[model samples]
Target: MSTESPSITGPLHDLTVIDLTQMLAGPYCTMTLADLGADVIKVEPPAGDLTRHMGPHREGDSPEALGGYFQSVNRNKRSVVLDLKTAAGRTALLRLAATADVLVENFSVGVMDRLGLSYETLSAVNPALVYGCVRGFGDPRTGGSPYADWPAFDITAQAMGGLVAITGPGPGRPLKTGPGIGDIFPAALCAVGILAAVHEARRSGRGQFVEVAMYDAVLSLCERIVYQHSYTGAVPQPQGNTHPLLCPFGLFPTKDGLLALAAPSDRHWREFCALIGRPELGHDERYATNTGRVAHADAVRDVVTRWLSSRTTADALAVLGGRVPCGPVNDAAAIFADPHVRERGMLSEVEQPGSPAPVVIAGQPIKLSRTPSAVRHRAPLLDEHRDEILSASSAAGDPRHNTSQGQVQ
Candidate 1:
């Protein structure tokens, strides 16, 4: 199958990452690295990542029957099966480790140690190998966590990490976010950790263990809540769609659907009042300043509600689009149709494995002028590159991986 864009040789082309992680958090981290042109060799178990079976899938998908969820995070990388439990498997992995600039995993605490592949063990073999992981609480290397052995998923982390408490419409109405930010935030942080470790390794010829606890990442995401509690001794409740300190900076119902408007600043609030034909309110004593408006939040919301109810989302945006930051609450179809999204190249069509038809996924959010990262190849098949990778002599057979010739996409 042909690609949508020319093969991108990215800025991280010289790096190699051994991906022992599976599922969302771990794979998501490596996927970011893979997208940037690192040689991410996904070392899966014989049964494969559980997400390999995750749907929704197309009819004629590969024997592996790779599903949409699997394809999203595993693209732009090669795959190889290895039973880490087996002696030969462990032997093969350590050999591969010798060539890896980084090795990442997200298994529960002590899985690597149980498998005799801990950072202490691997670092002995490859002194410059950056060992990174994402865990529920955290690893003991950086800081030991009391809940180190606790098993946590996205929801658990969201709840334990304080996000769920402050999310949703009101107190006692805690809500988990639609996406798995609990896992994703930790993954993003781990990526930064890997890069930092790699940078230091380049300078010192030494590597260190880097990790992110899902709970810690979620807490970091809710930094504002932390300070509010500390500064005022007030446990912030869910303020629905509104900002805690900024009145008129939240969701408002429009004629057709939900739309968001933010007039937190005095200039924006005055402009908003003028735009809604209520210029007098800009100077009204009741709504004079942000503090006064927030002191009478219901009155503020009522005015906004009345104004927005008079217009459709499109009509509202047409007038306010550039005047202030605003947009409609978009569905998938609407997002796909939006000109701004297309102009920014947010959606990308790619040759997906199993599906005869190409599927569209998100493009890189971080764009570089020279490197211009992209989705180069489809997600790999099970053990797709085993022969080419396991045998250094046979690496030439895989033209994509002949690094000596500067081709490593």
Candidate 2:
């Protein structure tokens, strides 16, 4: 590690991860680990991770400067460039892996095998190394998928995993989610698997390969539809903002904007009715219970809509903020201006290269009392820590040549 780099402090500070991942899914997973104080060494190719070339760069930043897409998830980690196609590069990676607690990658199914850096090979060099990977379909070691050889991205996974099937304003008009849940959800699961494998490795003095398929992760995320379809013997369809089972449990238009209100329970329903000046509706047999309210969803929606039509989102929130399960449908501007975001430190500022003003990105959500996660510094420049990493690896000495397997000095 470079002395100029900020010191990492968290629950995972002792762990060293060799990251051979590029783009979103893999980078996101490693970023999570890095945030938790893992010494993550991102081993990029000579040209660098493709995301570095992506646009939306800071003002006055040069062509070589990393863009927001890369910076957003690559922070709190060091970078080292290597030509993995060459024998020397492969040898260097093996040296790093010898000292690593974990090795993570997201290349296609056969990429690692082709590069001769498969989990089997690395684990032999360091038996206690927890190898983790994220794939579009899945790795053969986990379970063979028919589409294993097919190229995939966020949209493909979302569509195949059934997320797109049950999302949108109406049936037959499916829409992809605004964010890359297909990639992000898998990354989260992969991170969990890595931590679990690491824990077991410490206890058993052996490591295991942890894999997460993007398709599988997204399918798990859309669990509700699976159960719904199975139970009803009918395929689930898009129900717009409203849930099929819950009445008055979705977005409603207000004078100035939209508000997401959920008052399905009898207690909440009664209070909501009273707040909306429709107290009699609370006692009405047709609208009393959640079941009955679901039966009369249109009526319930009409009542809520009618009341909200005359009030701005702020005015509506004033009456139902804490009393009812209600919140304004916030956009980026509203979120930025929100007191909750400010107080919780949900947005983090980091210094940008060639820019005086710092750029803000989403902060770590996992809060721990003793070892809270943090962004210690900005993303590293390409090959920024190459010399330091190589020197450190050399000083540590290759564990591959040692008598004991997977022992970290």
Give lDDT per model, in order: 0.84, 0.89
How does each model score on TM-score? 0.93, 0.96
Clashes of each: 1, 0
For candidate 1, write residues 1-409 as lDDT tens digits: 1245646788888899999988899999999998888999999999888998789877766665567788888888888999999987887887787667899999999999999888888887777788999999998887988899999898988999899998899878988889999999999999999999898888878888999999999999999988999999999877689888888889999998899888877788889889888999999988879998899889999999998998999999988889987888888898888887787777877776555678877766767889877777778888999987799523324322322221112
Report the lDDT tens digits of candidate 2 across residue range 1-409: 1111255478999999999998899999999999999999999998899998886876676565667899889999899998999988998898898878999999999999999999888888888899999999999999988999987899999999999999999999999999999999999999999999898888888889999999999999999988988899889988799988888799999998899999989999999999988899999999999999999999999999999989999999999989999998888888888888876767788878767667777888888888878878889999999899999888867656852545643
Candidate number with greatest TM-score: 2
Give residue 164's lDDT in candidate 1 (0 to 100): 92
Model 1: colliding residue pairs: 62-354
Model 1 steric clash total = 1
